[model samples]
Target: MAAERGRPRLARDTIVGWMVLVLFVSLLSVVIVVRESLHVSVTERANADVTQEIEEFRTFTRTGVDPETSRPFTTAERLLTVYLSRQRPGSGEVIVGYVGESGVVTTSYGAGAPDVDEYDLTRDPAVLRAAEQGTSGTLDTPAGEMRWARTVVDVRGGDDAMLLVAVFTGEGTAEADRTVRMLTLVSLGTLLLAGVISWLVAGRILRPVRQVQEAAAEITEHDLTRRITVGDDDVSGLAATFNRMLDRLEEAFRAEQRFVDDAGHELRTPITVIRGHLELMDDDPASREVTMRIVTQELDRMSRIVTDLLALAKADRPDFVRLGEEVDLPALTISLEAKVSALADRSWRLAHVAEGTARLDTQRVTQAVLQLAHNAVQHTADGDAITLSSDVVVDPDLGPALTISVADTGPGVPVAEREHIFERFAHGEPPDGRRHSGAGLGLSIVRAIAEGHGGRVDVGGTPGEGAVFTLVLPTHTPASHDHPEQT
Candidate 1:
């Protein structure tokens, strides 16, 4: 097992919770502000009407007189009756005056207002209390409630009197109460709406977190291929990051598996040969010399296989390609042609060489080309021709790329076997009576080298018409080169 890896846990869930809290506070503030404002305004309107009616009564007391006699009213009840007849308030207001219980004066409009008898001075606590205390007061009346003021009127000849004025508030209280009810209903409904909206938004925003968890739960060391689907939202970044982590995990697991597999497959033959030879050894001088030579040969083959496996394993590392300097394609191609010429007796041809300097690992590129060249030689004869060529070709979708090709005029690759030959420890079937040799790692090494350069190798052409193995490499410029994929 490898060391455990982890990332910073995203704070999306917390963010959503805080957002809902802020929404609640904002809506509550609006309800309180609007409710308080409406309450203050309505209360002031009711109090203003009460104060205005009291002022009207005071002014009349100082100026009233009898119309027919052209002199002051003869009685307090007369003055009260004259005032009530002249005054008319809004439908919501009722002005009732009490003339010391001698008579009552009431002006009524709405259905809810009371009759003159209902305004009896002795029956109303507001009137009684005001008269006793010589101050304005309020009381619950038949017309819901009234705010009343009292004044003592002194006549020149008649008995001193009492005058009371009150404004009935049945309609006003009902209206204010209705307004409050409506505001409360609106506030509740708005809060409910805000809650629903906030909940939906929060769910949508944190959907990616659920997806990440689902993907993570399903992934195992043997299977890291699952990835989360995401949209173009803020959480998309998190999804992409999660996907990258999965990719790393999968690559690491595969690399470990390959190391075990390759070690067992390549090391088995040498160890068996060494043990068998040592066990069958004799004391004879000639037999010992032959045994030592055979053992030495087997040991050398094991060393080569180990070195090749190490090279292939390192292909997955970031520093596998060290394209630190410029490589001249023409010079490298010429050098490769010179090198592979001695591997066989084939008529090797330097078909074409493009003159250009590119950012590349010269040794790895040469190694891949030399591998292809040697593979061509192994499959060909003395008179058969093998050609190595290089040229920069332009592609509309891929831009400019360097094409390195090795073509052989021999029993060419079969259509179905070309892909198989490039896989690790894979070998193509020999033609007719011929036998294939080596650990079958040649083409795979070439492939690893190509991918290490952020490029790829592909085989084409027809069987018996000579196959062409091409290495299509980008110029290693950032705009042209992409991060390499697994070989």
Candidate 2:
């Protein structure tokens, strides 16, 4: 069956698009606020200028007298007419009138004046009261759509006159409106420019991220050599970290592939041997017994291979084996040493065997110990001393552990192959070019058993001084302890 799709559909480009949208929205909000502030400022300034003009006109109309003739006017109308006729064209226009003492307007700027008397100023209560009390008042005229400032002033001849100054705000209001429109357009243009720039900047920032994603997507099990180039920034750090992770993954993949290939090669050997032996039996009856013996040996070798593979697979599982009854470390070491001595004439000796106890699967522990001893014997000569020893050590960080060591007095492992000596199919050849006879699963199985028991194994030695292999197992602590006598 074809492999199911495992890649992500939303790529890095989709994320870049989202970032652009967010930046645009942020820019738009800023533009709106700035535009509104500008409009308000313009309107406020226009209103202030119009108010100042009204104030200046009121001061002139109230305090000014003719320079040539120092004569006061009889009525407010004559004074306002003189003021208007004498006013400069650029000095804003002012219209004056008078109301009775009871707040009645008896005279105005007269007829034939444009918008001078278009609206009744006295009809407005504020203006009428201002006239009665001789105070300044502002009125809104809908007909002219302008603001007029009215002040009641006493003429030089003691006649009460109402001074009306209509400050035309239509022009100023129109200017403010135009300014708002222009500001809005400018703000929108600026926002557009900013959005474009932000999009470009965001694209530049995400370029490395896109590269990383692309590089990762292109990396498959078959092709793990792809790498991403990064600039000298945070992206460089990210790229370095990613490359490190890829390095580890690649190493693991290579290790797994080697394991598979070696397993296959090892398995084929026994099958081929059995096939050859069985085929020879069909040619001669006298050789049938010899052929049967050869076939039996091949089958045994195949059985050992299958068994070791199963053990290794099981050891990989999280809960492959559980702790059993406590076993005495010293007793176990003695037994393993005796077995090694009997199997080979090598000088196998037990030393410094600590009286410690461990809760372990006894069968597996015994098997692991035997595997280590067998490896030691195979590597050393008949007369070489192979010392088997055990000790109880306390480490503050790791608590108590029972350590077992098998040291041989022969040539140690080579520097190049020392690290991988415990790996599958890593049986080291003899110094004289003689190969060891075994499935090469002994050390690997020993490692698996030690690790499965929450322990570890270490192997190291000087050249020509024979190697020392130590297995450290955690000491068992029972729930209820009655201290047993050390044997």
TM-score of each: 0.70, 0.61
**Which regions of candidate 2 are displaced past 4 Å?**
1-145, 151-160, 174-182, 230-249, 283-289, 309-349, 355-368, 377-386, 392-403, 408-434, 444-468, 472-487
Off by over 4 Å in 1: 1-35, 51-80, 89-165, 168-219, 222-248, 317-319, 322-326, 338-349, 380-387, 395-399, 407-416, 430-432, 451-455, 458-468, 476-487
Over the stretch 249-321, how does candidate 2's per-residue lDDT look in tens digits? 7876876776677679888988888888777666576688788888888888878887887787666544444
Q: What are the lDDT scores of the predictions, listed in order?
A: 0.74, 0.65
- Candidate 2 has its poorest 10 consecutive residues by lDDT at 1-10
Tens-digit lDDT string for candidate 1 (203-285):
67666777787788778887788998878998778988999989898988899898789989989998999999999999999
> For candidate 2, what is the TM-score?
0.61
Residue 81 accuracy (lDDT) in model 1: 70
Per-residue error (Å), model 2, residue 33: 5.9
